[model samples]
Target: MDYFSQSIKQAIRTVPDWPKPGVTFRDITTVLQNKTAFRKLIDAFVHRYHDQHIDAIAAVDARGFIIGSALAYELNASLVLIRKKGKLPFDTLVEDYELEYGTASVELHKDALKPGDKVVLVDDLIATGGTMLAASRLIRRIGAEIVEVAAMIDLPDLGGSDKLRAEGLTVYTVCSFEGE
Candidate 1:
């Protein structure tokens, strides 16, 4: 990894057996707490997309909102939220995906994007790829083209990036934990 990526990775805290046994959660709150780390994290993304013609950033719910809002402002692009089912107040399009134990859904407002809009999907991490895939589907359903999927971290052992690539989506991450 590059210098900025290495520093950002170091700022992340790994919580073992989080929410359940055998699950190591890669928490980003630490990075956000460190001003320098946070700036590097955002700058890494801004530098990559500044030259690209990006219309909007379609971010996955909750965590994705954090990175998405900053990136949208930096790139001069609109921010579109792909939220948890029923969280959106408008007419929405929903996509359901499988989780480890059950299925969950994400929703995008009907008018969030127009046809031919170029969007970058943002999330804090890629684990199983379910949420990102669902969000990408919602973007396509609205006739917007996903320019790429961006994340701060990737747990490649979980195969999320591979799953997204299998569906023909480009995946970008600042750093990856290979066997976590």
Candidate 2:
């Protein structure tokens, strides 16, 4: 494994039965809490797309916000947040998606991007791949060209990257869990 990948695995803390029973939630709070880990994560993401002229970073809501905003600032670009339904105040475009346990709707501001703007998608993790797919749909609907999709961790058993791969999107991650 690469240094970044190793760092991610070392930093992440997995908790069983979090938010419910029999489900393991990959907690990134542990990673974020570390100054070195957080800095390395930002550096890894920055290095991955160093040659790509990203115009903006489109981040999924909640967890995505933390990483996305930082990356946007590093890239000197704007940050677009795709939030849970009806959370955006201005004109918005929305998409619905099915989750492993349920369903959800996400929305983005209508003017988040101009036609053909180069963009990147950011999230903390990819599991089941539903939320990322929904976020990509919202980004495209807003007329942006997705330059890349980035996540901190990938859970392979969920086949999240495969789903995005089938859709022809490049998926990059710092680390992958055992099931992956």
Top candidate on lDDT is: 1
Q: Encode model 1's per-residue lDDT on 135-167: one tens digit a residue.
A: 999999889999999999999999999999999
Error of 2 at 9 (Å): 1.4
**What range of 10 consecutive residues in model 1 has the weakest lDDT sum?**
18-27
Off by over 4 Å in 2: none
Highest TM-score among the candidates is held by which one? 1
Model 1, position 149: C-alpha lDDT score: 97
Relative to the unseen true structure, what is the C-alpha lDDT of residue 82 in candidate 2, on a scale of 0 to 100? 85
TM-score of 2: 0.95
lDDT of 2 at 38: 96
Error of 2 at 119 (Å): 0.7
Provide the RMSD of all predictions against the true structure, rounded to 1 decimal.
0.7, 1.2
lDDT of 2 by residue, 1-180 (tens): 898779878999889997899889889999999999999998899888778798999999899999999899998889989899988899988899997678899999998899899999999998889989998998887778898889999887888889988888999888888652
How high is the lDDT of residue 8 in model 1? 100
